[model samples]
Each structure stands twice: as structure tokens, then as C-alpha cells.
Target chain A: MNIIEVNHLHKKYKAITAVEDVSLVVGQKEIFGFLGPNGAGKSTTIKMLATLVSPTAGTALIGGFDIVKQPNQVRQTIGLVFQETTLDERLTASENLFFHGMLYNVGRQTLSRRMGEVLEMVDLGDRKNDLVKTFSGGMKRRLEIARGLLHYPGVLFLDEPTVGLDPQTRNRIWTFIHQLRQRENITIFMTTHYMDEAEHCDRIAIIDHGRIVTLDTPENLKKMVGGDIITLSVTDRERVKSHIIEKFGLPVKESGQHLQVEVPGGETFIPTLAVDLGERLRSISMHRPTLDDVFLKLTGKAIREESAGAWSGMRVHMRGRR
Target chain B: MRALKAIYTIWLRDVIRFYREKTRIVGMLGQPLLYLLIVGTGLSASFRMSFAPQGFSYLEFMYPGIIGMTVLFTSVFSAISIVWDREFGFLKEVLVAPVPRWSVAIGKALGGSTIAMLQASILLLLAPVIGIKLGPLMILKMVGMLFLIAFSLTSLGITIASRMETMEGFQMIMNFLIMPLFFLSGAMFPMNSVPPWMATLMKLDPLTYGVDALRNIVFAGSPAREFLIQFSMGTDLAVVAAMSVVFITAGTLAFNKIE
Candidate 1:
């Protein structure tokens, strides 16, 4: 069954259309990943589905309940884990879960039962009484997941689950997400900037500038890009464009000092092409085309660009405050 | 049953959080202590005069006022932490919960009120050292006064907090609205001693009613202070209660409206 059906939803923040006529259907027991650059309406879309933000236009249905008209019902069915940690730092992990469970109208007996189960699931059972303030970042994050699952929600919405964590912690979170799916058979809808995380999802939608550029399975998306990603740094773009067109007749997408050649079986062609075009190439590198490569091909810029801009702007803002 | 449980659960979480933040707890007591020690003592003899209402000592008159001030500050800033929660996403957890939106706002007010009441009680405990004496009945009346004061002020604070889009904006409003409310309500000076225009503004101020009401209950049957205190408390409660409903309604309306 399609557990979540969002249809042509539009959310405008005054002059800015944060999400414009976007739509997607998430099936039962599947990990649906929302991939986008920063400020691309990924979080906005998830907020609408989670019923945290009302859409300016259109509708979304979660578990057959209309988000606009039946918000309470929509809220009941969806559990949201936001981009930032939201647990009460002063409260113990169990107390946090207890309150969260009660807010969803879970009975005392049931809340207690589930609380223990979730704490064990997150591996915070031993430290349930310890204050969340003392917990590490990854531990806090794990507790957040436990809080979300306390009510046994059918569709869990995780927004940028691993944005600022180290690689090892990020890997650990991925394992937990997988474990959650295996144990509960719950549907997961997650928004993330990490292109590599998209591989774990059953399907992904590459969203940018308030619109979905494309949607497909990870393997299918790579297949659409059609070969190893061949990136080159060219000294002279005009010479290189003509040289590549005349000599190799291979199609190349030029993007500011970088030429991406997406030939069928690009890895096999790279060595021969490199021999012919020696020294003309400032650099030569080959790798399997990833979601980032697909995003670059479709959007004409890397996904990392917006992320870098967001990070620097955030850093500057924080420093300015200090 | 479930709804009540949800409300209690939400309320309990706030209580737990406030209890855990030791600095915040100490800060709550610190303000009232400073008012009692410095403001209440440093100027106690200097400000004392027969012209003062009922010929009461400055400390005696100021005790209830300090109690009112404690209620005022704590009650209004109750939702400050919520703005932080909203920004951090803790609020989303609550917002998406199955409970009603009014409960959320009320739970916050109740939490803030509890803190205010606690602060007021602590101020009352320091009453003896500050040279104010109260009978057991008067102590009960003081508790009632604090509860009402805290409840009303918390509603006002939560309302303001709900309307605020940013934590900075909320803190600004707190400094702007709360401090003025305390100063203008005759907490720092006798109402009769203030300028005519300032007196007129105080008469209109809701905190003025709170101060007057609290002062009357704490010092019952003082002929000079009786009429104004009862009149202010009675009217203040009604007005504040009505205002709280409007603020809470507006808050829930905004919560439902915002995207």
C-alpha cells in the first residue's frame, strides 16, 4: 500500500516559493530518500508531510488521512526526526521518551513497555536514567530516534539524519536505520544532502530549487547516467571541445574548468582517450557515476556547492554573533 | 482520561526540565533575593516616612511588591525556552503529538506558573529576615496570591512567546515588556509617590493589579491599602484570565496557521 501520498503541494514563504507543486508517493515498508542541496525545499516538503507546516496550496494524505483537513490524524500517523537534535537535554533518556510517548496518547502500561523496547533498540537501556545533556552527539541522536518510535508510528520521517556527524557515526546511524526497518517493517521517508546515503533507499527523488529534477532507484539513476564518470580539467575549453568532438566524437558536458564525459563504458574509453589526448587534459579521473554525478549532469552544478555555501554562511553568521 | 494524561505528561516534562537546569533555578531565586536584600534593605530606612501608606515600613510595603515582581518576571519568560525548542526542533515533537494545541500552550503556561510560584514561595520564606511577619492564614493567602500571579503572567508570556518567530525576538520582547511591567506596577516604589502620569499608567497596568492584589492579601485589613488592593486583584484576575484566553487562542491559531 502507498502509506504516504503527497500531491502537487505548494508552500510559499512570502516571495519565496519554498516548495512549488511537488508531489511523491511513498510505499509501505520502503526507504524513500529525499535528496537535495541546501535551500532546495527538501526540509520544507518533509515538514508539510509531517504536518508541522501547512501547505499554501494542494494536499497530502498520510495513511489515507488528508493533511490539510485532517491534520490531527495526519500527525498521529507520522513520526518526525528533525535535522537538529530536539530532545530535552536536562531530562533523562527515559523521561524524554516517557513524555513523548504520553503526548501521543500512549497508555501508561504501553508507554512503559515500548519505552524499554525502544531504549534497548537504541542501546541506551543501561543509561536510561543518565541526563541527555551528558550524552555524546551520536547518543543524543539515537535517543531522538527512540523518542520518535515510542508511539509505534507507521511512517517515520527523518530529515537530514546524518548532516554534521563524523563518517563513523554516520555509518552507525545508517546501520540503526536499517535495523529499524528490519525490526518494525515501517516505512521511512528521509531527506538528506549526503548523496551516498541515497544508495540505502529503495528509491530517491533529486529535488532542487523547490522541484524534483528526477526520481528513480539508485541503480536505475546510475544506469541513466550510463557509465563511469570521466572528469577532466581542461586548460583550453574551446580547443578541448573541438578536439574531443573531432577526434573522439564523445559527448562532453563542460562546467567551468571541468569537462565530464559520459560515454557508454566510460572506464574502457578513458585509457584510450587519455593516450590520444595526453597533456591536453590538466587532470584525469574515473569512478562509477554516483547520485552526485547524476545531480551534476542534470542540474549543471555539483550538489556540494550549495552545502559549502550553507556551511560558510552558517559559520560566518555564528562567528559574527560571537 | 488520555487527554488529561497527555496534559500531565507535557506539564511534567516542563517541571522536570526546570528542576534539572540548576542555574535557571538559582537565577529565579537570585532575582528575588537581590530585590529583598539590596532594594528592600539598602533603601529601607532612607525611604521610610510617616507619609508612606498606613505608616508601614518600606520593607513591609516592598515585600509583597517583590513577591509580585518575582511572579511577573518568571511568568512572562515561561515560553522563552519554547522559542529555543521551536528553533531546535523539540517543539516539532510536541506539535506532531496527538494532544490538542491549547494543551500545549496551557502546559507551557502551567510550567512557567509553577516556577513563578516556587520563586514567590522562596521570597516568602525570606520574609522573616526582610522584617515582614505573616500569620499562617496570611501565608496561605500569599500562596494563593502567588499562584494567581504566576498563572496570569505565564499566560501572557506564553502568548508572547507563541507569536515570536525567533528566540532573539522573544528575548527582546521579554526585556521590553516584562521589565516595564515590573517597574510600572509599583514594585520598586510606592504608587502614591510616583508622578501623576506614571500613577495613571500604573492604575492601567495589569501588573499593578497583581501588586495591589498580592499586597492586600499579604497585609489584609490595612484600611489605607484595602480598597485599592481588592479592587486591583479582583479586576486583574478577570482581565488577565480573559487576556490569557485570547493570547492562548491566538497562539494556537498561529501554531495551526504557520507553515
Candidate 2:
């Protein structure tokens, strides 16, 4: 069953149309990703679905409650982790969850127990007494995820959950997120500009220009890129190209100094192709198609560095951490 | 019961934060001391007790007003922290919760008032040093006045702050708005014999009655001396309570419109 259903969701802020004609359904316990560049309406669409902002047109429902008409019921059934850090710096990790419990009407008797359980879920059980101000960027994100789960929400909405974290930290957070899906049986709907991050999703909706260009499983979307790219640099390029097409029945093209072909299972095809080419092949390499390629194929432009690159974000964060 | 819990939880968050903010504690304790020492001592030598009731010293008069001033700044600052919370995105956490918006406003006011009252309680300890002997009855009366004034002013603060989008606007209000409210509140000067225009403004200031009410209770302990009471005790509290409802309602309405 779909945990969230959005129908023709539209949002217009003054002159700009932030979200234009978006519709989709997210299955229960599915790790759904909204993949887009910044200003592509990713955050705006999520905010509307999360009931933080009312849509200008159309409607959405989460956990059988209408987002526009029954926002209070929707709020009770879903947890939200905003793009920016939202935890109170003055409060300890446990205190933040304690306050959340009361606001969500979690029983006083069960609040402490749930608090411990959620903190443990995020691997933050030891830092419960520490103020959130002292936590690192990654740890704070983890604490927020833990707090979001304390109410036993049926669904969790995360907006750029690991935007500023390092790569290793991002991977760890993804690990926890996968575990959360498996253990809690809760649907996870998150938005990301990082094409690599979308690869982890059960299905990705590639969005651009305030609309969903395409939605499919990551592997299926990449299949549109004609599978993994195999590049073979040979001393006798024409001879190898002819041999590849004759024996392997695969067409090969020349680019600069290398002969390249698109193939399925590039890793498995490499050894066989190397034996088939033998002495003529000097160097061989494979480039797997990523969600970026799918985005490029759909939008005709790469996700720009201004919004999607993680390394640029990493440099700003590394100033103090390292 | 759940709504009440939500309000209490929000209030508790503020109290816990106030406890940890050492700079705020210092400011709270130091502001009243500075006002009492500088204003009271600076005016004591030049002033005559002829216009004053019961031959009361100038320091004795400014004592209650100084505590009211402390409550004023602390309470307003507490409410203005919402602007900071919005900037930091912490306000969204509260806004998106299943709890109603009115509870959040009430919680903020209660929290600010509690912190303001706590800071004012420290000033109560200095009463004996200033030559005013306080009975337990007088302490109870003063505490009530502190809470009422604090809650009312905090509600006023929330009403003004809910629409403010930036912290830059915060300092401007503290200077251009709060300063005038304090100066005209009859805290520093005699309200009975002020200029016609000044008296009009003083009557309009809520802290005018708050300071006057505190003075009455502070001196009520010492029956031998008569203190200046601007309005009847019941009338002062009634004004505070009535205005609190107005401000809280306005604040909640403003909060409802926040994104």
C-alpha cells in the first residue's frame, strides 16, 4: 500500500512556480528519493507533502490523512527532519527528545523508554546527556533522526539529511536509514541533489524545472544510458573494433585514442573481452552509468556544481572538524 | 491534559536553557544592581524627602522599580528568543508538531514569565540590605506581583516578536520601544507630580502600575511608613490580567500565520 499519495501538487510563491504539476505515490517501507538540482522544487514539494506549507493547488495524503485538510492527523503520523539543523542547542539530546515526546503527546511513562530506544537506534545512546551544541554536524543529524522516530511515526520525511556531512559520515547515515526502514517498517521519503545518494533509494524521481521529468528504479533509469561504458585503448584500434563486433557482436566506437562500447555487466565482460582482444588491447577500463547520466539524459544538462557537488560542501565543513 | 503537557514542555525547555545561559544570569543580576546603585545613589544626595510620602528615602522608592525593570528586560528578552529560534530553524520543530499553535504561545509566555520571576527573586534577596524588612506575607505578595507583571509583559513581547523576521529588528525595539516603556513607566520619577503629557504617557505604560504595585507590597510589610500606590491593588492586577489576555490572543493569532 502507498503510505503517501500526492496528486498534481502545485505551489506558486509570488511570481515563481516552485512546484509545478507533480504527482506520485510512495509505497509503505519504501526508501523513496526525490532527485533534483537545487531550485528544482525538491524541497518545496517535500514541504507541501509534509504539511509545512499548504499547496496552491491539488492535494496529498499521508497515512490515510489528507495533508491539506487533516494536517494535525498527518503531523501525528509522520516525522520530519528539516534541511537545516533544528535541534535546540541549549538542550541535551535527551532533553530535545523529551520535549518532542510531550509535544507529540507521547505518554510520560513511555517517553523515557522510547527516548532511549530511539537514541540507541541512531547509535547515540551514549550522548543522550550531552548538549546538541557540542555534537558534530553528522551527530546532530543522527540525533534529529532519532528524535523523529521517538513518537513511533509511521513515516519519516528527511530533507537533504546528510547535505554537509563528510562522505564516510554520509555512508554511515545511509546505513542507519536502511536499518530504520527494515526495523521500524516505516516509509522514508527524502530529497537529495546528490546523484550518488539517489542510487541508494528503492526508486528515484528525477525532477527538474519544478516538475518530475522521470521516475523509475535507479538501475532501470541507468539502463537508459545504455548500461556501463567499456573503454579499450589498443595499438591496432580498427583491428580490435572489428574483432569485438565480429566475436562479441558488440559495436565499438573510437573516441580520442580509445575504443569504447556500452555493455551490460562491465565487470564480468572485462575478462572475456580482454582475452578476446589479447595483445592488441594495451589498456581497458569501465565507467558505470550513474543517476547523473540519467539526469543529464532527461534534462539535457548535468546537475550543476552550485547545488549538487559534495566536495565543495566538504571543504567548508572540514575547516574546523579536521 | 495533553495540551497542558505540550505547554509545560515548551516552558520547561526555556527554563532549562535560561539556567545554562551564564551570560544571561549575570545580566539579570547585574542590571538591577546597576540601576539601583547608580540611579538611587546618584539621585539620593540631591533629592529631598519633602514630596515623598512617609519621608521614604529615594533608594527605598527605586528598589521596587529596579526589580520591575529587571523583570521587564528579562521577560522581553525571553520572548524575543523566538526570533532567534526562527533564525536557527528551531521554531519549525515546534510549529510542525501536532500541538495547536495557541499552546505554543502560552508556553512561551509562561516560560518567559518564569525566567523573569526567577531573576526578580534574586533581587528580593537584596531587600534586607536596602533597609526594607520583608515579612513572609510581603514576600508572597511581591511574588504574585512579579509573576503577573512578567507574564503580561512577556505576552506583550510575544505579540511584538511573532511578526519580526530578523534579530536586527530585536535590538531596535529594545532601544526605541522598550526603553521608552521603562522610562515612562514611572520607575525613575515621581508619577504624581509629572508634566501633563508625561503623566498621560505614564498612565498608558503597564509597567507604571506594575512598579506602583510592587512598591505598595514592599512597603505594606512596614505598616509605620505609607508608600505611594498609584492604583488600587485589585485594579492593578485586574489591568495586568485583562491586558495579558489581549496580548496572548494577539500573539497566538500572529503565531498562527508564521510559516
Which candidate should be chosen as best, given DockQ against the real structure?
Answer: 1
Which residue window of length 10 is worst by lDDT in model 2 chain B? B220-229
Candidate 2 docks at the CAPRI level of acceptable
Off by over 4 Å in 2: A227-286, A304-322, B53-55, B221-227
Docking class of 1: medium
lDDT of 2 by residue, B234-259 (tens): 87888878878888888888888887
Clashing pairs in 1: none
The worst-scoring run of ten residues by lDDT in candidate 2 chain A lies at A313-322
Please give the range of 10 consecutive residues that has the lowest summed lDDT in model 1 chain A: A313-322
Model 2 scores a C-alpha lDDT of: 0.86
lDDT of each: 0.80, 0.86
What are the per-residue Cα lDDT tens digits for candidate 1 across A1-322? 7998989999999999999889899899999999988889998898888877789999989999998889888887878887778887778888889888778888789989999999999899999999888999899888988888888889998998887788999999899999999999699999998898989999999999999999999999988888777888877878887788888777878765788787778768888987877887778887888888889878988888778778868545533421
